[model samples]
Target: MSYVLAGDVGGTKTVLCLYQVADDNSVGGSMEEIYKAVYPSAGHERFSDLITAFLAEVTQRPERACFGIAGPIQDQCCTATNLPWVIDARQLAEEFGFADVYLLNDLEATAHGMLHLSADEFVELNPQAMPQAGHAAVIAAGTGLGQAIMAWDGQRHIVMPTEGGHCDFGPNTRQEDALLLFLRERFGGHVSGERILAGDGFGNLYDFLRTSGFAAPNPAIEAEMANEDRNAVISHHGLAGDDPLCTEAMRLFVRIYGSEAGNLALKCLPRGGIYIGGGIGPKIRAALESGVFMQGFLDKGRMARAIEHVPVRLSLNPEAPLLGAAHMALLRSQG
Candidate 1:
């Protein structure tokens, strides 16, 4: 028997899992999940410390390990985008006494995992979707916005991670033009799409609407924001239509989210598909299905028909990154 360690490391949280594999250790080998846990990313000062704690609770020592991290990976090293830790694959392997270790960008891992998921795990948003063989794009908005491209090489997909989320924000409507100005002033200049599409975007959008006199600020929501997760509160009220300010914010968020997804589709022309993954999408499922998102997506001036039939899917599985890491480790181990 052999063990594999896999992790999905994000800015806000980290999830680690241990999988027991059959003796064969082949790509077709059977595997069973033995343990899994989630931890606050900020609780550990070093990535090594967190791994050490995880290992202490388990009796088996993994032969190989892989991590899907939220940052750019260069030369097997990563400086986590939202966390204070710098992770090196070789260093982790040496310190942990593992035979091998691999690091992949979080979106890359998600893209890889998408191939292994069952059909039911996805919700196809494009009614006119046409599934075919080609490249695909992934866009996820979590603590930050993540983007990746899955290039199909006739046999398999080669996942390419990107920092495209930090690209310049383009406004398509008059309201978005005002939003750009507002975010520019607030961020001191040059606001990225991530500023309006990520988790914190709920609060940013709500504040923008309130200051714009869209509606009177709800004192109850304000009080809740002071104590609880500001974004959560806003999204909750927004989804429920309990407050005009939050509802409008939610609408704006969905619009921008759809627009950005369209932009990604246009850029890559992911004829295979474009997938939506992140913590925020499922929670706001109603808003996403509310036609506003689709309208924004199809708003592409002349190029609308080019990608109109391209499938857009939303991944319901939040553990995709971890699963991808595990499968990737398994494949690498076989080689």
Candidate 2:
């Protein structure tokens, strides 16, 4: 059996997969989930080192490899936005003795993965609209915000990467207007959408609420946060409806998230749909369904109805990037 290696290289974790694509040119056949593993991205100093460890686990060298990385791909190389690693497809191929290697923006990989996913893999957020015929968009908020679009040419999905997450954040309410100023002063210049929509952004919002006197912190939460993951702690308290400050932070976060999601829809006019992927979406699904996200999304005045027709859904498959990378490896192998 010919093996295809795929890697989903993200800010927090890196997942590597080895898939057995049949020699008969069948890619997505059943019983093809070979081996997969996850490693902390930050804990490793070099991506090559991580690959080396993973390669040792395999019985033999893979014929082809592809990596979906969390940054822009240029000249066969990528410097991950949230990590200090620089990945070069050529270097990887040379070092690993592979005939070819491919690199893609993580969201681009996600879009590819979306094509292979079954209907059961997704959780619908807006079931009112049908999956319209046109372009489709994917927006994920994990360590960073990643955006991509898929062109449906009446046949297959052609995925494209974008740096839209770095755009200026437009606030929808007075409290958010104050949030922009607060973030601007601290971030020291422009506050991008990723600044307030990502994992660290949750902590930033919680801190802002505490400092702005809008909500006071609990001693227990402060103590727990001293050791536990701050974002997780805040999200836990917020979603449980226990802490007022935490709930308010979640509200603001949902608001900003929806606004950005809507902005992406407006720009791309993704009539096909909008898929919300990433670590954060599934974690805060309750908060998202609390009407804040859709409210901020539909608050776009005259353009509201158009985006409303854009189906919103969540990608529950965490291995989507890996699956996408494997698909890319299959596609590259065909050529």
Candidate 3:
């Protein structure tokens, strides 16, 4: 039996999985999982090296492979956004001896995976949401922000990857106006939405609050920053309301996140809905559920009503990108 390989490549970590395809092309046949592994992305010098190491561990070589990468894809090649590696689909196929290789933007993969998920896997944030048939949007904030659109024809969804997260940051309030100036100066130029909406945004916001006298810095939390992931620590304390500064940081983070989501909705007018996926969304579920998120979402003047009924869903599954890559591989292998 031939094997199919799938991977979810991210800034922090990479997960690879192998599945054994059914020998017969029968209607009831299915692929079975055979192997899976996770690796720290920073530990490997090149993506090719990581692939070589993974292939060494498995006995069977895959005939086809697909990877969901955190970057823009061009001509089936990608220069990873947060990693220092260049990935080319054709080169990997030749080097790894695979019959075919496929690459997708991380959010595009997540959008494909969303189609396969069950209703229970999603938490609806819009009380008045109306699920309908139309185009849809997907936005994720992890190490970086990602955005995609699922253009639904009468038959199926066509995932369109975009670098919308890099768009200019729009301030909705007086405080956010200050935030724009602060980030602009810190970044030494044009500040993108990701500056205040991504994982590291927690630390940025916390620093702003502390320096702005929003609240006195917590000595204990500050000390932990050096030992742990500073962003994660800030988010943890912020979500738990353990420190005033951290709490405000989370509030501001959630606010900006929702505003950006709204911005995506305006661009695509996704009537099917907007699915929020990423490593950070599930962790801060509580903060997202607070009314602050929705308030920020609807804060748009004159255009708020256009997307009020569009469903805003938070996907709880973190392995969606991996699953999507696997399924895409299986489909391509069959064809």
Model 3 residue 76 lDDT? 98
* Model 2 pairs in collision: none
Q: What TM-score should be assigned to candidate 2?
A: 0.94
User: Per-residue CA lDDT of candidate 3, range 247-335, in tens?
Assistant: 99999999899999999999989999999998899999999999788888888899999999999999999988987787788777667
lDDT of 1: 0.90
Candidate 1 per-residue C-alpha lDDT over 1-335 given as tens digits, one digit per residue, 9 for 90 to 100: 89999999987888999999887756634678999988899968999888998999999989999999988999999999878999999999999999999999999999878877789999888888999999998999988888999988997788999998999888899889999999999999999989999989998998888898889998888999999999999999989998999999999999888888999999888999998988888888889888888778888999999889889898999988998899899888888
Encode model 2's per-residue lDDT on 67-133: one tens digit a residue.
9998889998999977899899999889989988999899899888887888988877764667778
Cα deviation at 160, candidate 3, in Å, is 0.8
Considering every candidate listed, which one attains the maximal lDDT? Answer: 1
Q: TM-scores for all candidates?
A: 0.95, 0.94, 0.93
Candidate 1 segments exceeding 4 Å error:
23-29
lDDT of every model, 2 decimals: 0.90, 0.86, 0.89
| Model 3 lDDT, residue 142, Cα | 87
Q: List the residue pairs that clash in candidate 3.
A: none
Please report how far candidate 2 places residue 299 from its true position, in Å: 1.2
Candidate 3: deviation at residue 219, Å?
2.1
Please say which candidate is ahead in TM-score: 1 or 2. 1
